[model samples]
Target: MNPFLKPFACHWTMLDNVRVKKAGDIRLKATRSAVIYCTPCGRKLISQAQIDNYLHETKSKLTIELFVFDCKANMKQHYCPDGKILDADISNGQENVPISVVNEVDKEPNK
Candidate 1:
């Protein structure tokens, strides 16, 4: 199997409209193609074009899903040139997934 298309079981994190420093680049701002994965599963950068193709094939633009494995990886920021915030479903099903950042108080327990 191609290294690019490996079976990666993990949660998806969307770097939507995120502006920040890029990787391995001196430039302060960059869309650095990010590799997304479940912090628990495996890590890999899926291809965005591949995901688009899959959605196109299904002929349903209603639910856009990011495949954790295969060619659904993106090059960061959804490559939106029009500066539009494209709302998407980060779920693997017809349901919505809730995500939250850990609070400082929660970290205290680890200390």
Candidate 2:
């Protein structure tokens, strides 16, 4: 196993959009969705339901850390950009495995 990769567990955080009112009060508003990523690799998970299904099928324990951020876009721009999206394939029936698909942003240039 690679030291940098923790494939068995994931991390999830709630992203909130904040706004400043006229009274100079800061308010935190929850977004429509949250962002889930691999603990070590920072690979983004499609949804909470998908990860739950994958963990259930694989009998793997998940370690979640609740981090609240003001902006979802900032978090995606900084951390999730380095890793590709992780998709769990449960349809195969043999074994449940998480697959990392390479997006255009995650591709490397030819040497």
Candidate 3:
């Protein structure tokens, strides 16, 4: 009988709601994920916002850097800190472009 409380209740109970949201799928497009890789170590750190949040909360601001030895081999797969493999734009993550033009290069020839 309560109208205002209905939406919140729906959000709380339904596992289906979390399954897939827009675009007929739940996984986000690749552009949404961050490009994270560790250098001189095998740990790849994706999710820029999460990383920034960690740095912010911890108050330990040390500049973290990554060197792309081989973009393909390094970025073959990505995972969140929690160990969930991210599916954001994996298609374009592996590419070799001029140092200045990495993101702008055309990686989509399959279309």
Query: Which candidate ranks first by lDDT, i.e. highest?
Result: 2
Whole-model lDDT values for every prediction: 0.36, 0.41, 0.34
Model 1 spans > 4 angstroms off: 1-33, 37-45, 62-111
**Higher lDDT: candidate 2 or 3?**
2
- On residues 7-48, what C-alpha lDDT tens digit does candidate 1 reach at each position? 222233433322324442223234433433322223222355
Best-first order by TM-score: 2, 3, 1
Per-model TM-score versus the true fold? 0.20, 0.24, 0.21
* RMSD of candidates 1 onward, in order: 17.2, 15.3, 21.0
TM-score of 1: 0.20
Residue 73 accuracy (lDDT) in model 2: 44
User: Clashing residue pairs, candidate 2?
Assistant: none
Comparing 1 with 3 on lDDT, the higher-scoring candidate is 1
Q: How high a TM-score does candidate 3 get?
A: 0.21
- Tens-digit lDDT string for candidate 3 (1-111): 233233223331111112223333445343323234332223233444544554456564332222222223433244433233333355565646322222333444323
Leading candidate by TM-score: 2
**Higher-scoring candidate on TM-score, 1 or 3:** 3
